[model samples]
Target: MGLLTERGELEAERLTPAGERILRAASTLFYERGIRTVGVDAIADAAEVTKKTLYDRFGSKDRLIAAYLEQRNRVWHAFLDDQLAALAPQTPADVILALFAALTDWMAESRRGCGFINASVELAAPDHPAMPVIVAQKQWMRSEFMAQAALGGFADVQELADRLLLLHEGALVCFRVAAMEYAPEVAHRAAADLLAGWPRD
Candidate 1:
């Protein structure tokens, strides 16, 4: 976790008020603009801090990018956890299928596109600092699907989780790249169809 391992030390390196501003500013610019395009000068200006202050906090652009993904993953996971917790009393199908609707809402608000996906594309090198954060976010999603599928009593939990995760990934890709409109709804319907095809015990 060299880069991500730094994450384990977040509490020790908790941001100052100015550091918070730097992170928020970077998050918006990096996500809205491509990661490579948004320079540290731009982020420092937006955050209303000196370039030296930015460097003091983040060390370098790579570290800042890693922090952004970690921040994004944190917020995204909290949102998902809240959604699933609220769905606790509902049918497992309802809980599992809420992903599409969630994506619809998220995409509607985050029109710039998937933050992690954007990072992946912008930072193509496999060893890029932000790569691990992106990988962890995706793996967490698939793992969450597996947990929900098992609780849902799906006949094939792993298979079902895999298909559902594919639908989730496909919907995001469609929203960003392929079919922009009607993507989430189409994925939702397809998820329902998959649910129908795979009966639970």
Candidate 2:
């Protein structure tokens, strides 16, 4: 979704004012509530536009979902970049580990859990319009982890990244499903242990 651009906020020139409002309304409602549970009418009402306007702008609810997801991915990536800049992590290991803190902040902001994961569960169709956006978000996260592992001088960077990605996703699930506030902390500790044993060469 956001892999294409650094601009994720609604102000990006890609959408018209009304279109942006529609997407913004859908993003909040869909995340706060389930995507399927919130219909086009509700989104239109929330955005203060007619349902015809929504269909004309987005074409359909499925496409709207994709747009919303793309907007969210862009916002999330922008946030991570900001956080990374603020931390000024000296090493790849520091950057990777520091992502846990970022995740914790994200979790607090998004009490319902990962929006991509939630949409996947609700949509249930691999061929849905939003699937590409969802897949892009995951692929970007995994690839970033791999790049970080390589930067950290891990000999088995691919395998290390695979494990780290697993832990990262698992923590998101655990936090959402089990409602565990410390899931990211546990995942970070586990990642630290794994990194400790990996060959640095």
Q: Identify the leading candidate in terms of lDDT.
A: 2
User: The CA-based lDDT of model 2 is what?
Assistant: 0.84
Which residue pairs overlap in candidate 2's backbone? none
> Model 1 scores what on Cα lDDT?
0.79
- TM-score versus the correct structure, for each prediction: 0.88, 0.92
lDDT of 1 by residue, 96-196 (tens): 67766677777787886689988898898999888988887777667767776777788878888888889988888888887476788888899989987
Q: Assess the local accuracy of residue 68 in candidate 1 as a C-alpha lDDT between 0 and 100.
A: 92
Number of the top TM-score candidate: 2
TM-score of candidate 2 against the unseen true structure: 0.92
lDDT of 1 at 92: 60
How accurate locally, in lDDT, is each candidate? 0.79, 0.84
